[model samples]
Target chain A: MATTEVVVSILVSTLIGGIIIGYLSQRSRMCFVGGVRDYVLVKDTHLLKAPLAFLIGAVVVFAIASLVASMPTWPWFITKSLMPIPGAPLAANAAVPIYNHIILAIIGGLGIGIFAVFAGGCPLRQHVMASEGDKSSMLYLLGFYIAAVVFMAFILPNIQIF
Target chain B: MTEQKERKRIIKHSYLIIIAGLVTGLIAALLQITAGVGPPNAPVAYGICIACHGRDLINWIVNAIGGTNLGYGTLVAGVPVLTVVGIVAGAFISSTKNKEFKFRTTKNPGVSFVCGFAVMASALILGACPLRAVLRVAYGDAIAVVGFIAISVGVVISAAVIKVNARRAINREVT
Candidate 1:
């Protein structure tokens, strides 16, 4: 396939997948923040099932698919060690040092977990909220992209810690 | 009221909802793996991230509308996350279909944006969102376990804080 053809295929396939997932997400209101909150507050496991199932399903399917297909698979986690190799792309073939993983996990995870609650939803929930015309969610999304861009360009380079 | 009732029924049927969620998640993952739409299955699993993918979408929009690119590789890299766009659009369609599309306004926009900032920053730091964090664990990235633990701790702590604040508010009202 031509370069343009490859890009188009990737985008189209991804969009279709997103549409399928988002439609179901909207139908079910499957959200991690609400799920965790409910589980903590009321001992309810109902909402938690969505994320758990996604994890389980993704693990099983991806493992089996990769094995069966005999295609090369990247490491299970973010590969930071291979990145900054002088010519590697940011999105593809990037890696981080193993020592840094610990800090990133604890602090990063806690922050995302906490703020997702304050934001009133998970990432999936944010998309649904914006789609439903929630002004606050839209603002949150705006902040999301802006911060994402700035972080990737500026903050990510300077951070020696997690 | 009817729409609300219907939503309640759907939630109440936990088994059906779980099955549907599982199917959709599996299909999404399968398609992403096949399509090779992303770097790998780590911090970004295809186009699933809100913050990262959202940036991609926003940059495309901004550039299309006459913003100048500085010619840096990242600045000029044109990977528009149409999946994220499709996500919101699909959600809009579903919300409208079920009559659940409520236009929610916020009393505090500053805090709202702050929450977004916090989420994106932390997600970048962590190298993944909560969803991908769990998957990272399954993928055998042992480091993510600590992150997952922290996520649970954060949730439980927030719940306690919220409860305490609510009780305080109630006491003030009663007084």
Candidate 2:
């Protein structure tokens, strides 16, 4: 297949997937942290089930796609190697370190967890909510976009400790 | 007698939750298998995430501002836009059918804004969020796995803080 055809097919598939996800999320209220929160706070396990469902769904679909369609499963670079994009500063000369850095990992994790709570959703939740026509979610997404720009331009440069 | 029916309802709800969880996991695993390790081929990341794409966007922006010639992150960024557009359109259709489309707000707008900033910033720094992070980890991305663990810890800690705050608010109300 031509490159453009592949790209188009991918886009179409993604759109279909996104649409299905949006519909499911809207109907199911599938928020990852929210599910946990609901279960913890009220003992209501309804929300908690969505993430589990999503995971299971993704795994099954991925397995089938891999077996029949020759779909790529698990990119090797993300795991075993870090391809230093020619001049990128963040690109490491060595393999990206994998494990045993508990402190930094914990700190980063805590930061994400707290922020998700405050944001009233995780990244996945934001997408789902945005799909459901939440104007505030749109605003949150705008923040996300701006932050991405800022991180690349300013913050990343200053933060030597990654 | 009525309590028995209520108990049954709760059990059914629990069953639904379990089923959904299984399905979601299966789909996620499938996506991982299909996308492989290199850049995703279709829908450009196979419903992966905005964070990874956003990281590429940042890389492009950095290269542009620094006047260094680099590959544009358009493919990564553009896919999310398409997916999100599809999502909004889907939701619109669903909401219209269900008659649930209404503008609403919470009492704490400032908090929400801060939360949004923090979430985006953290996700950007880590190079992915929970969904993408988990997917990456499943695919054998070590950094992503670390990031996922970090996010989980973050969530648990934040939940604790929220609990405390809620308690304080309750006490204030009582007084």
Number of the top TM-score candidate: 1
Over 4 Å off, model 1: A74-97, A160-162, B1-12, B38-44, B60-77
Per-model TM values vs. the true structure: 0.82, 0.74
Separate clash counts for every candidate: 7, 53
In angstroms, what RMSD does candidate 2 have relative to the true structure?
A: 5.2
**Interface root-mean-square deviation (Å) of every model:** 3.9, 4.8
Q: Write the per-residue lDDT of candidate 2 for residues B1-175, one digit (tens) a residue.
A: 9999999988876675566445445544543343321244322223455555444545556566787443323353333224455555666677767877776655666666666777766665454566666555444455555666677667667778888899999999999
For model 2 the local lDDT of residue A86 reads 15
TM-score (0 to 1) of chain B for each candidate: 0.75, 0.65
Of the true interface contacts, each candidate retains a share of: 0.64, 0.46
What TM-score quantifies how close candidate 1 is to the native fold? 0.82
